[model samples]
Target chain A: MLDMIIDFFVIGAKIGLILLPLILAVAYTTYAERKIIGYMQMRLGPNRVGPKGWLQPIADVIKLLMKEVVVPSGSNKALFLLAPILFIAPSFAAWAVIPFDVELALANSDVGLLYILAMTSIAVYGVIIAGWASNSKYALLGSLRSASQIISYEIAMGFALVGVLMASGSMNLGEIVKAQDGGLLHWFWIPLLPLLVIYWVSGVAETNRAPFDLPEGESEIVAGFHVEYAGISFALFFLAEYANMILISVLTTLFFFGGWLNPFQGIPFVEEVTGWIPGIAWLLLKAGFFLFLMIWLRATFPRYRYDQIMRLGWKVFIPVTVVWLMILTFMIKAGVGPWFTGRGVL
Target chain B: MTVESVVFYLFATLTLVGAIGVITMRNAVQAVLCLVLTFFSAAVLWMLLEAEFLAVTLVLVYVGAVMVLFLFVVMMLDVDYASLKAGYTKYLPLGIITALALFGGIYWVIRSEVFGVEQMPEPAKHGADYSNVTELGRLLYTDYFFAFEVAGVILLVAIVAAISLTFRGRRDRRGQSVPMQHQASKEERLRVVSMESGPRQDGQEKTEKKKRIRRKKGGGS
Candidate 1:
């Protein structure tokens, strides 16, 4: 019993540790997005807040909390209320498998990558339920569109991940990073560049970001599935979207960009200098770059037409990933690559 | 009671209650939600059995993708509560008999000496890094290759069958070509045909006047 009590305390502490940083990440992600996007548009974004909008996320949170949550008259009461919590829970829960540094993950399970994928897959439920519970036509349509979009892109994403799995020879996130410890060439991205690209696109679609964000096009659907949501409810959906983006960025770094490893590990002097920086810094640098790219893509690309986005995912992305997956399998089996050192290579 | 036992009991109860809810819920959507609940609870139980990969996959595939589709269909369905319950009494006897036969078969299998506890003992606790995924993959590839291949073929056939059944291309309908659209200049959409403006044709006007006169004459008669 005492052991169990200690176990609970340890678990709580770990969760609190992760959540504190994560919540801060989610909060600042919005600020970074606005500032970055603002610079792109040649404007100062929210400078009126605490020192160049650094504290804007906190102000927004307070404002959202102060607002009233208005449930629609015809809405399904119970499910409507449950939707936001459901959306936000899995977004944070998937963080358990993410190795911040070498021994930093809460649950360093055997199937870490798979766990992240599964947790992400389950997030669509909250969106579907939220849209359905809203009892609004626009909400229903938006949710359906978003649900189908996420599901379709997830296939391409999964195939792209198969390339990572083949290269690393393990589903464990730490093992995957460890496989790429030697250098830039050792990273899976060198050979699996196409898969990496597809993975990024899939990540964009999965989060319903710009270009693939036809589901929630403010002009068309008036903010999509969460159109009816207000106050903290709306804020939760917003947080979940950004959290998923961060999650995707982190996964991208871990899989293809060699998470927590210096960019020039093979170069003797470069490696020595860069290695002095902590592993967590490299990991953050890679993930932040991807996150910045996400915002960059949002600001650069026009919203893709609905059918066009669907066609890209199904016709283009899926087939490419599938063929690449087969090629990767053969490559691993034949032991042709220098990177296939962990297993099946001479 | 020990902690593990207590946890197991909690999961067991959740699964049982969810299963019951699946059948008893009057709303079809509610029933589908209950089914999802049951699937997830079963996954939790699988975790207790130290099959974490299987558990997560179950939650991922069944509760995530399959149940979403199920919910989509159920939500779209126009269900009448009275009509749904109408078949209950009519099928009660047959349902009871079939259920009993199924229960008896399961009972026989469980009670058989061939399938005793000695045949399949509990798995020993593994270390922190014992990957169930790798173990399962190795087993599937080596000892059960043929079975795995057969299953893959069956699933592929099912996919083909589903696509063949539903996929109908309507060539009559026009579809946009993105390149064609982009390459399209003002010349394609707008054609300039310089022509003199002619006076309005009086033929249609005369016909209209004649029809009006005839109608007036007919009304007079």
Candidate 2:
């Protein structure tokens, strides 16, 4: 009993170690987004708080925490409160199986990738509940759009991952990374380029980020589902969105760019020189790059129209992924490339 | 009780609660949420049985996609709870009889000699390295291959049927053709009608005069 109690505490500490940094990273991602977008627009962003706006997220957190949580009179109080928790919990829970190093995962389950997919799929409920519980038409409309959009993209996303599964022949995230062990060319991104693009784009749509952010269609619906949410309740939604952004970035890195594997692994002198840097650092750097790419996309493109977003998800991306999946099936069957040569029947 | 039994009971109780909530909740949205809760608890029970693939897939497919769509429809509906409740007392006797019959049927099945714990002993636990997914996959591909293919075919047919039922390719509706829009050129949209650079014509002057008179009248009003 004493040993079990100690183990529980140890696990709690480990979880805190992962989540604390993740939360901080999420906070900074907002700062990075603002600054990056600011630069693109030729303006300064939130630089008044501290040096280079280093303390901006902290200040924002304090402000949000101090504000009153104003639940609307017409809202369902139980579900209204429950929505934010549901929205945020899955983003955090999915982090458990994300392998930062060789043996640094919380739970190295065989179905880690599927677990993450399941967790992300569950997040739609948060949006739906928030919209419905608020008793607002705009909120309901926003959530309806969001739920449908997410479901549509999820199919494409699942197909894209099927390409990865065929390549690596493993559902275990750690094994998937290990399969891409030799060098940068061995990475799944090289062979599965279309799927990578589809996955990332679907991920953006899944998170309701621009240019696929018609759910919030600020001009059309005025902040969408969380319009009635205030203060900490609203902050929770904000946090969940940012956390999911980071989560997608990390997942993209893990699935395509090779999680925690050195990009210069097989290169001659560069590998020797860069080998001293830890695996976690490489993972973080790659994830950060993807995060910047997401922000860059936000700055570069206009928000997609509602119908256009749907069309892209269903007509364009789904077909592309399906075709790629068929091509992948042939390649795996014929034993063509480094990725497909030694794989057993999927 | 042991830890496993404790966990089992905890989830089992939650499952029962959620099932009860599904029937008892007044609000339609709340009732759907309770149904989701019931599904979730049952998924957890499946997880306890080491059927992780099925459990996660249940959450992913049904609780995630299907339930969200269900909630979407339920929220959109403008239900009249008062009208629904009006017939409750009128049908109470029939409802009670059906409920008791269901209860009795389930009880008889469980209490029968052929269906006791002794008849179906607990499954042996597997080691950490044993992957149920691989085992399940092998079985699915070999033994259940034809059934799986049939299921896939059925789903495809259903999808086609649904699309045929709802899809209307109305030419007169004037929906945006995105490909055409993307193909649009500056020349097509902007008619740069070239003419000699000259002073305004008599018609332009007349229009300007009319605009000025209208503006003057509006200001006076």
Candidate 3:
């Protein structure tokens, strides 16, 4: 009994380690996004709060927490309440599979990619429920768009990932990163260039960023699916979105950029030498790069028309990914290049 | 029973209850909700089976994508609750007879012993690797290569068929021009002509010069 109690605390602390950073990251990410977008727009953003608005996220958090959650009159009260939970749960659940470092992860399952993919896919429900439960047309429309967008993009994204899985031959993220040991050129991004590009673009679509963010196009849709959400209900959606952005970036790193692997090789104690820099920093840097790209796209491109977005995803992305998957399989079997020779190559 | 078995039974009960609710619910949307619940509980049961992959896939594919789409369509349709209730008394005897016949057949199959009730082979003594995904992949590629390839082809054909069907009944005069849309380029869409304002400036072109500068600045932003 005593041993079991001790194990419980250990397990809890382990879980807390994963959860706490994510919460903090989600908070700071909002600040980073605002600051980055602020610079892009040539405006000083959130400069009033602590030190160039560094503490602005905290103030926002406090305000959200203090605000009263107003349930709409006609909404399905039970499901309305459950929607945010459903939305938030999958975001947290997905963190379990991400290998921050080789040894540091909440749940280092062999099927880590699949698990993350599965959890992320499940996140659609939160949007759907939030849309439906609001009993509002705008909410419903937003949800419908989100469901279709995510579902379509997810298929293309999965196929793109299949190319990576084909190259690496392991869903284990640690192993995938280890395979990219030699240098950046040897990374899966080189041989699987088509996949990398497809994955990146589809990932943008998956996260509803920029041109693909038609669901929440402010001018037309009026905040899209979460239009009815306010106060803490709205805040959950906000948290989920940024967390997902982080998740997508982390996945991109693990899949393509060699998660936590030192870029320059043969340096004595490379990972150890960088003890001053935490492993989480590399992961964050990669995720931040993708996040920045997402923001940049948002700032630059106009939103895609609904039909056009669907056509691009289904017609162009899915087919291209499918063809590339076939070519990758054939190349691997036929022993075409260095990828075939090196078992260690990711 | 062990704690695991007890938990298993609880999920099993939830699954059965949800399944029953799916059939009995008068409201079509409520029926769909029950169906969603059934899918969720069934996924939980898959978790009990030690098949996390299948469980998660069930949730991801079925609950996440398929059922939500179902709900969207079902709720939007003007399903007549009165019409659903109208046939209840009239069709009761016929429905009962059909259901009884199906149940009897299922019971006969269970008792026939054609399929043994033997337990699954015990997992390897080394314990679970959680790497069953890799093993499944190896088997699919090597041992079942032909079957796997055939399945892929079938799926591809189905996708092609679905897209073709979607395009079949289009009567709109301005139907989307696939080839023309594909051929469209930025240069064609936005034309640039150079015209001197007063003197021949170094960058006198309006759109072209502006575009060149915009493109370069756009690179960083």
Candidate 4:
């Protein structure tokens, strides 16, 4: 009994350790986005706070906390408040299953990938409820757009994951990384490039980031589902969105970019030197690269028009992912994967 | 008394409560949400039974997709909650009869030892690292292959049926062709011809001259 109690406490502490870093990362992701976007656009972004606005996220948090939370009249009060929690919970909850290092996971269950998928999928409720409960037509419209957009992209995204599942043959995130052990060339992206493209694109769409951000098209729908939200309520939604972006980036890294693995394992001196650095650093570097790509895309590309977004998701990405998945299925079944056979990701 | 039993009972109670909420809730959206809660709690109960794949897929399919879709429809439909309760007392006897019949049927099944507590013993406990997904997949592929295949085919048919029923291609609707839009040229859209500011020539006499002038422009020739 005493041992079990100690085990629970240890597990709790481990979870807290992961969560604190994750929350800090989430805060800094916003800061990094501003800085990167600023650099890209050749404008000074949020540099008024601490040195280079390092404390900008903290200031933003304080501002949100100090503001008054406004619930509109003729709104479903219960669900209005509940929406942000539903949205925020799943985004952070999915982190419990993420394997940062080889043995460092909170849950580390067999179905880590599916668990993440399920949690993210449930996040749609937040938008839907928030929109409906806002009692505003604009909010309703925004939420509806978010719902359809998420559902449409989810199909393509799910198919992309099917390709990864076929390649790795394990749903455990650690196993997925293990399967991709052989540096850059042996990464799943090489074999399943089409699926990788579909996955990454759908991931951006899933998170409702720029270009695919029809749900919150500020120009048209006035911030969409979150238009009616204010103060800390809106902050929760904001945090969830950024958190999801980080999640998607990490997931992309884990699924395709070979999470936490040295990209030059075969090279003699380089591999030995690279091995000295911890695996988590490699994972963060890859995920950060993807996150940077996201901000760059946001800075460069214009928001996607609504119909075009749908057409791309339903018509283009779906067929591409499905066909690629079929090809992948055959490739895996025939034992044709050169990466899997001899070296075993080295 | 045990942890498993406690968790199981907790989930079971919540499931029942959610089901009750589903029936009693005045708002249609709230009722649908209650149904979602019921489904989720039942999934938890299934997980307690060590059916991890079954439980996760339950949440994935029913709660994630089906309920959300249901919410989409429910939220769109402008239903007055007060009207939903109007016929409640009018159909009390019929409702009671149906409820009693369902309860009786369920009780009869449970009381009979065919699939009751006596016949259905607790499944053997697996190790901490046991993966039910692999086991389930093997069983699904081998022993239950035909049934699984049939289920998939039925789902495909259902999908086709639903699409056919609901999908209406609108000829009245005009949408932009992105590829055509992208392929469009400035010359195609705008012809910057420097014709004489006034009429080039007489009505009939200018036809040939107009053609010659257009040809000289070099784009439409």
TM-score of 4: 0.91
- Native contacts present in each candidate (fraction): 0.56, 0.67, 0.50, 0.42
Model 4: per-residue Cα lDDT over A219-327, one tens digit each: 9999999998999999999989988999999999999989988898888889987788988898899999999989888998999889899999999999998888887
DockQ of each: 0.43, 0.62, 0.31, 0.36
Off by over 4 Å in 4: A1-8, A342-346, B1-6, B112-116, B193-221
For the record, the alpha-carbon RMSD of candidate 2 to the native fold, in angstroms, is 2.8
Tens-place lDDT per residue, model 2, A48-139, is 99998999999999999999998888889999999999999999999999999898899898888898999999999999999988989888
What would the DockQ be for model 4?
0.36
In Å, residue A51's CA in model 3 sits off its true spot by 2.7
Across residues B1-221, which tens digit of lDDT does each residue of candidate 1 receive?
55677778888898999999998887777788788878888888888778888999998899878998998998887778787678988999999999999998998888757578887777698886677888899999999999999999999999999999998989787888777888999987999999866644768788677779989889641
Quote the positional error of residue B1 for candidate 1 in Å.
Answer: 5.3
Instruction: Give the clashing residue pairs of candidate 3, or none.
Output: none
Identify the candidate with maximal lDDT. Answer: 2
TM-score, one value per model: 0.90, 0.94, 0.84, 0.91
Q: Comparing to the true complex, what docking class would candidate 1 get?
A: acceptable
Candidate 1 local lDDT, residue A223:
80
Error of 1 at B148 (Å): 1.1
- Best-to-worst ranking by lDDT: 2, 4, 1, 3
| Tens-digit lDDT track of model 4 for B13-123 | 999999999988888899999999899899999888788888888888888899999999998898886887799899999999999999999888777567767788878
